[model samples]
Every structure is written in structure tokens, then in C-alpha cells.
Target: MFGSLGLPELLILLAIVVLIFGVNKLPKLGKGLGEGIRNFKSSVRTEEKTASDENGQDATKDANNT
Candidate 1:
């Protein structure tokens, strides 16, 4: 439901976007948005992997100390 935006609100937003950008540009816009989201997800995953590796080392150190 997009937080506060319902289905009707989404339809209105879509109509406004179509009016502003036209139907022809929608495909390219969608493609660019998809690529941006994909890249962001990949970078976040890489960061999580690095953080987990550091955490694993810390855990090993703590175990040895005990």
C-alpha cells in the first residue's frame, strides 16, 4: 500500500507520470530504475558480507580469550 498511498493514489500518480513523461519514455524509465535498484541491492549485499567477515573474526578472538 506504499505506506499512506493506496491503490487509488497510485493510479493517480501513474496518470500524472504518464502525462508528464509520455508513454514512449516509460520503458526506458522503468529500465533505468530497475538497474539502479539492482546495483543498490548488490552493494548492500557486499557490505553485509564484509561486516559478517569482521564479526566472525571478533567472535573467534572472543572465544580464544575465554
Candidate 2:
């Protein structure tokens, strides 16, 4: 997935993150990342539901016409 990052570049990025957050905080950071992903998924599902509801209403109107 990280096709653009060579070994040195990846190491540099990791070093920066480690410096900023430290080793002890990585787990907490991971948990927060997971929560963020879950929230995003839920938001996407809600948007899909709203769009489907609108489409269903339109379909019902079309059926009524026929």
C-alpha cells in the first residue's frame, strides 16, 4: 500500500511519529483511530439511508401514476 515510501522514508516518518506521540501513547492513538473509523462508517450509513428513503418516495409516486 505504501508503494511510494522506501525504507529510509518510512523510517523517517515513524521516527517523527514516535517523537511526537512516544511509544506508550501508540495504543491510545490506535484506539482513537478505530473510533474515528467507526464513526465515519456510521455517518456514511446514515447518509445512504436518507438517500434511499428519498428514492423510495419517488418510486412510490411513480407507481401511483401507473
Candidate 3:
């Protein structure tokens, strides 16, 4: 639904964010956001790997039982 945002909309959103957070805190905000996103991505990857490994083990167990 939000896919239609263009340059003006982005600029206005940025302006609002700047007004809310102030320029001095922007760097810290960006750093925290980056770190949070990185942590989230890493956790998602770990979960996916664990799930795949479990599925593989289950399949092997089923084959041995047959």
C-alpha cells in the first residue's frame, strides 16, 4: 500500500524524523537501527538453518524406520 512514495514524500518524512530526533542524535539512531537490523537478519538465518537441519534428521529417521 505504501509503494507509491516518491521524492517529496520521502523528503517530508525525513524532515519530520529530523525534527523529532534532532540532527545530533541521527548518527546514534542510524547506528542502532543498523545493528538491530543486522541482529534480526542473523537470527532469522540461524533459525532457518536449525529448521532445515531438524527436517533432514527427521527424514533420515523416517527412512531408517521403514
Candidate 4:
């Protein structure tokens, strides 16, 4: 999606963000956004792991029953 945005467009976007949020709050906003993304990524990974584990256990149970 961002493949079409050139440097100038990115700079303009950054300028708009800075104008809207101001420089002082940018760091806090960035930190919160980062933490949110991190948490989301970790949760997704954990969910995928649990799903795979469950599938593996079901397969094993089926094999043993047979």
C-alpha cells in the first residue's frame, strides 16, 4: 500500500501529523502505538501457536483411537 508513496508524500504526511499532534506529544503517541502493535503481534503469534498445537493434539488422538 505504501509502495506508491514517495518521499515528498511521506514528508507531507509527517508534517501534517506533527501539526495535528504537536512535537511534544509525538513521542508519547509513538510509544503507545508501538506498544499496541507489539501486543497485537504477540497475541497473533500466540493464537497461531495454540491453534497449531490443538490441531496436532487432535491428530494424535485420532491416530491413537484408530
Candidate 5:
């Protein structure tokens, strides 16, 4: 596993990325990545909320029937 990369290793990786993608594209790539992660997190939160609501309804029904 990648233990924390030291500063030199980090700079090397960054240099490679810049070479591959070019400096101008890096900002666009970073923005897209940020948006993707944000959307993923929001979707996960929504699914969790829906699941919890369904569980609550089931529990209430069981309690009423008892």
C-alpha cells in the first residue's frame, strides 16, 4: 500500500501528471473530480434517508399490530 508519500515522491507524481495531462487541463480535471465526489456523497445520503424512513414505517406497523 502507498504509505504516505514523502514530499519528493509527491512532487514526482505531480510532475508526471502534469506531463501527461498538461497544466491547463489539471484545473478542469480537478473540478470534475470534485463534482463527481460531491454527487456521489449526496446520492449516498439520499439512499440512507430513504432506507431509514422505510425502516421506521415497518417498526410503527409492527408496534401497532402488537
Candidate 6:
């Protein structure tokens, strides 16, 4: 999707962000965003694993019941 954004477009976007957030706060903003994304991804992985484990257990229970 982002393949269409060339250097000029990226630079313009970056400029807009810098103007809005200022250079001094960029690092803090980036760190927070990175941490939020990491936490979200970790939770998603844990949830998927839990769902798969539940499904596996259910399948075995059904087979034994029959």
C-alpha cells in the first residue's frame, strides 16, 4: 500500500509531523508509539495461542465423549 509513497511524499509527511510535534518531542512520541504497538502485538499473539489451545482441548473432549 505504501509503495506509492515516493521520496517527495515521504519528506512532505515527515515535514508536517515535525512541524506539528517539534523535534524535541519526536523521540518520546516514537518511543511511546513503539511500546504501544509492541504491547498490542504481544497481546494478540497470546490471545491466538489461547484460542488454539482451547480448540484443541475441545476437539479431544468431543472425540472422547463419542
Using TM-score, give the best candidate's number. Answer: 4
Model 1 spans > 4 angstroms off: none
The candidate 5 region of ten consecutive residues with least summed lDDT is 1-10
What lDDT tens digits, residue by residue, belong to model 5 across residues 1-66? 568788899999999999999999999999999999999999999999999999999999999999
lDDT: worst 10-residue window of model 4: 8-17
User: For every model shown, what is its TM-score relative to the native structure?
Assistant: 0.83, 0.77, 0.95, 0.96, 0.86, 0.92
Where does model 5 exceed 4 Å of error?
Answer: 1-3
Predict model 5's lDDT versus the native: 0.97
The deviation in Å at residue 23 for candidate 6 is 0.3
What is model 1's C-alpha RMSD?
1.7
The alpha-carbon lDDT assigned to residue 12 of candidate 1 equals 99
Candidate achieving higher lDDT, 3 or 6 = 6
* Tens-digit per-residue lDDT, 11-64, candidate 6: 999999999999999999999999999999999999999999999999999999
25-44 per-residue lDDT for model 4 (tens digits): 99999999999999999999
Model 6 lDDT vs. the true structure?
A: 0.99
Of the candidates shown, which would achieve the greatest lDDT relative to the real structure? 4
| Candidate 1 TM-score, true structure as reference | 0.83
What are the C-alpha RMSDs, in order, of all predicted structures? Answer: 1.7, 2.1, 0.8, 0.6, 1.5, 0.9
Which residue pairs collide, candidate 6?
none
Q: In model 6, which regions exceed 4 Å deviation?
A: none
The per-prediction tally of clashing pairs is 0, 0, 0, 0, 0, 0
TM-score of 2: 0.77
Which residue pairs show backbone clashes in model 1?
Answer: none
Cα lDDT tens digits for candidate 1, 1-66: 479998899999999999999999999999999999999999999999999999999999999999
